[model samples]
Target: QQQVKQSPQSLIVQKGGISIINCAYENTAFDYFPWYQQFPGKGPALLIAIRPDVSEKKEGRFTISFNKSAKQFSLHIMDSQPGDSATYFCAASQQTSNYQLIWGAGTKLIIKP
Candidate 1:
């Protein structure tokens, strides 16, 4: 019930196109959902997030669409760029577990120039 499943293990997008990555979880106890972006040889960094109460959250070119009832969420990258090429991970955390994040397998995105 604590697992987050991600899809499209790898994606290729033309520059200026949109890149979308999806994830699903089975744990209703999860209260915090955050997406992380990681570059090679570096730790992941918070990209965007949404609470169970929020349907959507956007930051710059990144947007997260959440469906609390469906236990699903997706990340959309607007105007994808080569610089945006990286691995993305979706994670969930609950207040009861000391806020430990249960992670989704990484999605590797490549923006073709």
Candidate 2:
């Protein structure tokens, strides 16, 4: 499995500010990379995802709009709030690699009041 590099080991975002997390992978064989958000005392949950062919995907305030050509992806949190503070992870997987995913070193996001 190829490693996915995520930037900004930690992030501090003010309320209503935009929080952006970035990730890049070297394996072009990796089909899709998904962003997961884990709140305290809770397991990680899928926030959003982008298909290999698609450049972007958005849901509510979270976006996984990506640059497939560069094998880079991002999660954008618009109107960030304290409630949004959590550990965010980016994961990559290959079609033939079964369900096993290569995870990025997560970024701890703090949305300040």
Candidate 3:
């Protein structure tokens, strides 16, 4: 079974709008949750991450809200711009097995002008 699940395979937002992506995990052992953003040719880059100890984290226009009890997390982008259009992925990792990350099917976001 897939350890992590994400919703809304694709999304479209107007410029200066908000974009949201959500994820859920089945593995309770997962302690590290991270979001990645990738362009067409470049490798995925870490956008933000949160540990079980924190409920939410925000950096600039990006925010990550986590619900430990629900084993779920969501990423929110505020004031999304055209440049923000990209594929976003949610991942979970634990201390076991060298902390290998279990990836979720990515969400492709398109920001319209």
Q: Which candidate leads in TM-score? A: 1
Against the unseen true structure, what C-alpha lDDT does each candidate score? 0.96, 0.90, 0.95
Top model number, lDDT: 1
| Model 3: per-residue Cα lDDT over 1-113, one tens digit each | 33799988999999999999999998888989999999999999999999999999999999999999999999999999999999999999989758999999999999999
**lDDT of residue 85 for candidate 2:** 97
Model 1 over residues 57-97: C-alpha lDDT tens digits?
Answer: 99999999999888999999999999999999999999999
Candidate 3: the clashing residue pairs are none
Model 1, residue 76: displacement in angstroms?
A: 0.2
Q: Using Cα atoms with residue i matched to residue i, what is each candidate's TM-score against the true structure?
A: 0.98, 0.95, 0.97
lDDT of 3: 0.95
Candidate 2 C-alpha lDDT tens digits along 1-113: 38899988999999999999999999888887889999999999988877788887889988887888878899999999899999999999988889578999999999999
RMSD of 3: 1.0
lDDT measured at residue 56 in model 2 versus the true structure, 0 to 100: 78
Per-candidate total of colliding backbone pairs: 0, 1, 0
Candidate 2 achieves a global lDDT of 0.90
- lDDT of residue 31 for candidate 3: 86
Top-down lDDT ranking: 1, 3, 2
Segments of candidate 3 deviating more than 4 angstroms: none
Candidate 1: lDDT of 63? Answer: 97
